[model samples]
Target: MKFNNKIVIVTGGARGIGASIVQHFINAGAIVHILDREFPDSFDVGGNDSVFRASGDVTNSDDVKSFIKGVVTKSGRIDSLVNNAGIIRDNMIWKMDESDFDAVIDVNLKGPWLMCKEIAPIMREQNNGRIVNIASRSWLGSAGQSNYSSSKGGIVSLTRVLALELGKNNITVNAVAPGLIDTPMTRSLPPEVFKKLENTIPTKKAGHPEDIAHAVAFLASDESKFINGQVIHVDGGKSIGANLH
Candidate 1:
């Protein structure tokens, strides 16, 4: 019950890591609101009434504002905001389309900025809040992912800046960097490619969505109030430069 009665917002909670993060908050007793383009036929509540689904786009300022307003209108205040919406269009820079790069940056980096902008005042007035941005260990470096890597790196920087600006208000901002998580996206890779990537990881395995969810939950909970502006890598040591030999 670390987050009992708290009002929490998660972007892209329909599936993958976001869905797990939403469930984590729900289990901890937080009233979780999800902002996504569309929720599935049913937003899985597991018989819990603490889940709210708002259909919206994080890249749209108006949508972002409306989502926040709707959540606050219902909950009266916001406690934590997890910016988790992201997409990838991987290709080498030479072969990548300009639109693809823009798209990735807009959704992955700008989306979080919009959410933080809309929530900053509310959290500031409350004088207490938490913000957790989902970055990627690929932000450090990754081939054929120039746009994705750049977007996640921007997330890392944004986390630090927001923590500096919001720390005085007792609002801590942090990030979770996930590496090789076993989600639909990763599983969709060709068998040989997937195996090669898995073999490259120090653990020789891809992490589950719950692993990322747990790290995100910790940053959003009271236990991490003092740990701000940091990026926690839940990558099974893959971020430490895995040995391919």
Candidate 2:
């Protein structure tokens, strides 16, 4: 029980990587609070009575604040924050609309920005905390994803800057850049496109949300106290070389 007695907040925890992260933390004996617009179907997570659900939009300041306050009211303190809420709007820069870019940025970038703005003070007072931002490998560059890539790239930048500013307070900020992971979003892709994506990964397969969760668990735990301000790539070596058939 690495996270025993800890309280963690996970945004977008209803599905995908966020859900996996929530379950992992709960399994490790941490009380997990999920901030998301919708709740997931009932699933047993360690049977420890460690799961808390808060329904709200991460992009809305009021919603974010309320969710945090609710968590604090129940848990007294937050030991870790995982900014995992994100959205994708695929299109080239020339074709992308201002609203589309803003929507993606609002949720993917500004959402976490607001979370930190509200929660960092609590962490500062506690004199120790961990914040893990979920970014994407597409931040390096991606075709037809100007909005998503830019939003994720901004997360990478935010992670490093926050780590620097918060380190003195014993708060470590880090980002996890995941490659292709099988999720509801990717499941919608055409079979041909999905196959191409798999062929490109060095592992010849897409990643799983659990893979990213494992990385996050380590960063959120005491073992990674020395690791900070890093944008860890959870990709399966796909970032090293473009998948070419």
Pick by lDDT: which candidate is best? Answer: 1
**lDDT (0-100) at residue 113 of candidate 2?**
98
Instruction: In candidate 1, list every pair of residues with a backbone clash.
Output: none
What are the per-residue Cα lDDT tens digits for candidate 1 across 1-245? 37899999999999889999999899888999999897777657675679988888999999998999899899999999999989989999999999999999999999999999999999999999999999999999999999999999999999999999999999999999998988866777788888888787888898999999889988988888889999999988889985866
lDDT against the true structure, each candidate: 0.92, 0.91
Worst 10 residues of 1 by lDDT: 39-48
Q: Would you estimate the TM-scores of all the predictions? A: 0.97, 0.96
Alpha-carbon deviation at 244 in model 1, angstroms:
1.8
Residue 48, candidate 2: alpha-carbon lDDT: 54
Poorly placed runs, candidate 2 (over 4 Å): 42-48
Writing each residue's lDDT as its tens digit, candidate 2 over 57-115 gives 99999999999999999999999999998888787788889999999999999999999
